[model samples]
Target: MTVTAEREPAQVATLDPAAIAREASPEALSGTSRTPALLIEHLSKRFVVGRKRKPVTAVHHVSIRIERGEIYGILGANGSGKSTLIRLVSTLLTLDEGRVAVFGHDIEREEMRVKRLINRVSVDAAFFKKLSPWENLVYAARLYGLEAGPAQREAVRILSRLGIKESRMSRPVEQMSRGMQQKVAIARALLTSPALLLLDEPTTGLDPRSKLDVQTFIEELRADHDATIVLTTHDLDEAERLCDRIALLNDGRVVAEGTAAELKTQVVRDHGGAATLENVFMTYTGRSLDEDVEEESDDAE
Candidate 1:
């Protein structure tokens, strides 16, 4: 693979807040180029678990390039480090080694800039349960320094588009179904119109109709808002539908990568497996998606 970026400590230190804001603006996001939306180079992370404190390599020197406007999927079974990689890129966890950049901004050195450019939504999204969906979103908007008037309007619009009715907006989020809460999480993440969105198992646990709605909304975001998405999913069919390219991860390493059709072709020809994602997963990961891999160590960070 090509070196996605060279170390630029000096340049990172000199980036002005105004310039960073400008770079993350909607106008800037409108311009498309060959520059990747995300680049991971030799990224690695390990957690110490157990009474013996043995190290478990959650992510092991994995690298991938996600292009602007592309939906890049990371497909893996449980405990395969998909969430760990996403956490590292979102700065929720510190990496043990390697580098990551979001739209040319170094994640470590230019963290604020990177934060401005990206947003993440995970299955276990946290919210103040007592607050209404609208209130929760407005709070998030205020933190992003958005004016209340426009932010509320945009929040309402996004929530409505996600199938939330105005009547439901004012009710405490704790009363809503898990699927509805997930939609609220998605709407909040989109409030800034981020250039890059990290979605970790976004449609997991949703009813079929709700899942389809979210999936359609994701496609719309990429087509209409010039957003690049990095999605992690165990749903092979969903990955085949949404991802421009996918990386199959196993044991914290990327075992295969290609478009869905490309991967199916390879598995049939090379591995003598059925021309299906299920077989591809079985061939590579050596297990079914529903089978939970027990945590090998006593402590997993």
Candidate 2:
């Protein structure tokens, strides 16, 4: 399990669900009065490694903003700083420099308020092995200060929509497949109706069918709940299918940012006709997005 510092300065309590929904009203969302759901400025993170001590810059002066109700995708290879960025925004890691804000509240100054506005679901979602999915989600709900009755109902509803069977809700999470556990983690995050949802490789390690299920669930969440999402993934096809806009991150920096079609158009213009997203990624990052690390390892041996 990942661990970080436990204490931070307190801020105002989280806004009520009713208040958040009211702010997300169609009129509010359509008007200029709407505040951005997330704003990140000049973010950077570094890690120290080795006995001789070397500094590794995981993220370097990266900045982006996600509007309310938008699904923004970050596309990158392993160790390219996507997860590090998410952790910084979620306040799981203190920033080495720069700033992040959620719903106009500064993450550093208003940590609790920022925490309330967002929830993160990474590939390796932590859960109690002995607890059932329903029980785990209920526990999460309690932590978020939700009442038992409404929390239980919402958990069931979200999980069911994610293709989890009602019959399996009582089984221990350890017995469930990885995909199912992922769905449960997502459901737990949605139970609090967060304004900003950070999903770090949410579909990683899932079979095709399960990936589709999770993708569909994500679309529905944005449509029905007006949630803003920031997702990081190495799956270019999934990014093309699900993202409203994508940022291509390579070596801790954003090399390109545009809609999928826009990116493809740029590639075609630069590299002659018949250029695809794959070609675009190759041209910009000098690496194929489909090249698996395991395949490289096998070849090396």
Q: Which segments of candidate 1 are over 4 A away from where they belong?
A: 1-21, 24-33, 292-301
Candidates' TM-scores? Answer: 0.87, 0.87
The true-versus-predicted C-alpha distance at residue 235 of model 1, in Å, is: 0.9
Q: What is the C-alpha lDDT profile of model 1 across 120-182, one tens digit per residue?
A: 999775899999988899999888778878888888888899999989989999999989999
Q: What is the lDDT of residue 127 in candidate 1?
A: 97
lDDT, each prediction: 0.80, 0.78
- Minimum summed lDDT over a 10-residue window in model 2 is located at 1-10
The per-candidate count of clashes, in order, stands at 1, 0
Worst 10 residues of 1 by lDDT: 6-15
How many clashes in candidate 2? Answer: 0
